[model samples]
Structures are given as C-alpha cells and as structure tokens.
Target: MTQPDRDPGLQPERTRLAWRRTTLSATVAAILAAKTALHGGASAAGLVACAACCVLWLGFLLVAHRRIRDLAVPGRPTALAPRWATGAVLCTVAIALCAAALVV
Candidate 1:
C-alpha cells in the first residue's frame, strides 16, 4: 500500500506549535526567576527584573501569535524569518534568565 501524502501546511502547523511551546517556556521561566529574585537579597530589584522579563515575554508572545497567523497563506515565501523584536527579545530572555539565576 502507498503511504498517504502529508498536508502542505503540516510543517507550518508544527512550527506554530513550537513557537507556542517556546512562549510557554519563557513565561514559566520568568515566573520562577521572579520568585527566586523576590526571595533574594534585593527584593526590589529582583521584582523589577521579573516584571520586565514578563513584559518582554508578553511582547514576544503577541508578535509570535501574529506571525503564526500568517503562516497559512499560500504565498511563495522561501525561508522563515522571524521579526527582529521577537528574535531579540527571545535571546534577551534567555540571557536574563541566566543572570537572574546567578543573582538569585
């Protein structure tokens, strides 16, 4: 028997799911870091950093959601190019998480 062909949008759907997972991970990590910071020596600074990380994650979530919505279109896009803000904030969040861990 012949194998069934995959849907054209299957890749995009998987990509969208991956983005959602990334956003979720960022949110959880931010919350944990915030909690760690709150109990650290500098409560004020830790809380402030936590708030900033949450805000940045929120921004990336919104941008990723919007970009994924356009993934279903039949345009002839060659490669995946994430928006600058999304990529920058995602990297920033990773670095901030490390810094928060050290400080906490």
Candidate 2:
C-alpha cells in the first residue's frame, strides 16, 4: 500500500499539539499549587488563586481549539497571528499562583 502525500504546509499541527500539552501542564500545575497553598493555611488566597487559574486554563483551552481549527484550514482571506497576550496572561497567573503558594 502506498502512503498518501503529506502536505508540508500543515506543519502547524505540530504546534497545535504543543499548545495542547502546555495547557494540560498548566492545569496540573495550578491544581497542585492551589492544593498546596490551601494546605499551608492560605485558604482565602488559595481559593481565589485556584479560581483564577481555572478561568485562565479555560481561556487557554478555548484559544487552543480555535487555533487548531484555524491551522487545519488554510488560504483564508484574513491571516491572524496567534495571540501572544493569552500566553503572557497565562505566565503571569502561573507566576502569581506559585508565589501565593509559597507564601502560604
């Protein structure tokens, strides 16, 4: 059996997978950090941090899905650059949560 010719232009699929993996890792990190902070006696702060992290993760998930869909279909009239703001937000939240966890 002969394999079909792979379209090299669809290379964004690799990036899509990477985005998914990052989202998953961030989620796990958030859960662990929130749990630790709560256990360390920063109940209120920890809960808030956890909620914020959850929201951020959801945002990332939605963006990742949209990006993957966009990548799947090429040649659209308007080309959009990936939103770096989302990534910056994720990093900021993660850092804040980590600090909150440590202080707790």
Candidate 3:
C-alpha cells in the first residue's frame, strides 16, 4: 500500500526540535566555559569576557526557544534565529580566547 502524504507541519516540528537541541548544547557550552575560566586560572580579562559571553549566550537560547514555540503554533510564520547563530559564533571565539589565556 502507498503511504499517505506527510504534513508540512512536520517540517516545522523537526526544525523546532533541532533548535531546542542546539540551544541546550549552547547552554552546556556556556557552563563549560565558566568552569574553565574558574579552574584554569584564566586571566582576569579573559575570565570576564568568557563569563559575559556565557550570560549573553543564555539569553540567546531563551529567545530562540521562545521564538520556536511561537512558530509552532498554526497562525505564526516561522521565526529564524539569526541572532542566536551570531551569538554562538561570538561565544565560541570568547571561549577560545579564554582557553588561550590559560596556557599563555
């Protein structure tokens, strides 16, 4: 027997779940950054920047999750997370710099 056509809504649901997973990973990364700064004897400037990046990254995650939930509803168009991606890139850079500070 032939399978029935899949609903378009499934696309958004899958995308939403992917976003949630990404956000969760980001939160964990932020935590790791903080721990590295605290225990690695990172320089003051580096530690501060890493900590700030963690806070900002969390904010991005929160906003992305909220937007995904809102988009899951039938009436709303999907909201793309441009800001979150940008924040993630910046946070990665900050974390890298902090790690470097620990070694050098």
Highest TM-score: which candidate?
Answer: 1
Steric clashes per prediction: 0, 0, 0
Judged by lDDT against the true structure, how good is candidate 1? 0.65
Q: Write the per-residue lDDT of candidate 3 for residues 1-104, one digit (tens) a residue.
A: 53344444577778778878877877786677677667757778757867676676766666676768775776445556687567657765665665676447
Worst 10 residues of 1 by lDDT: 73-82
Task: Note the residue pairs that clash in candidate 1.
Answer: none
Can you give the lDDT of residue 93 in candidate 1?
59
lDDT of the structure predicted as candidate 3: 0.67
Residue-by-residue lDDT tens digits, candidate 2, 1-104: 53344445545666667767877876787677667657757667677766766666676677666767776664431244646545646665765656565665
Ranking by lDDT, best first? 3, 1, 2
Which segments of model 3 are wrong by more than 4 Å?
1-9, 40-47, 79-88, 91-104
Q: What lDDT is obtained when candidate 2 is compared to the true structure?
A: 0.64
Q: Every model's Cα RMSD, please?
A: 4.7, 4.0, 4.8
Candidate 3 residue pairs that clash: none
Question: Which of 1 and 2 is the better model by TM-score?
Answer: 1
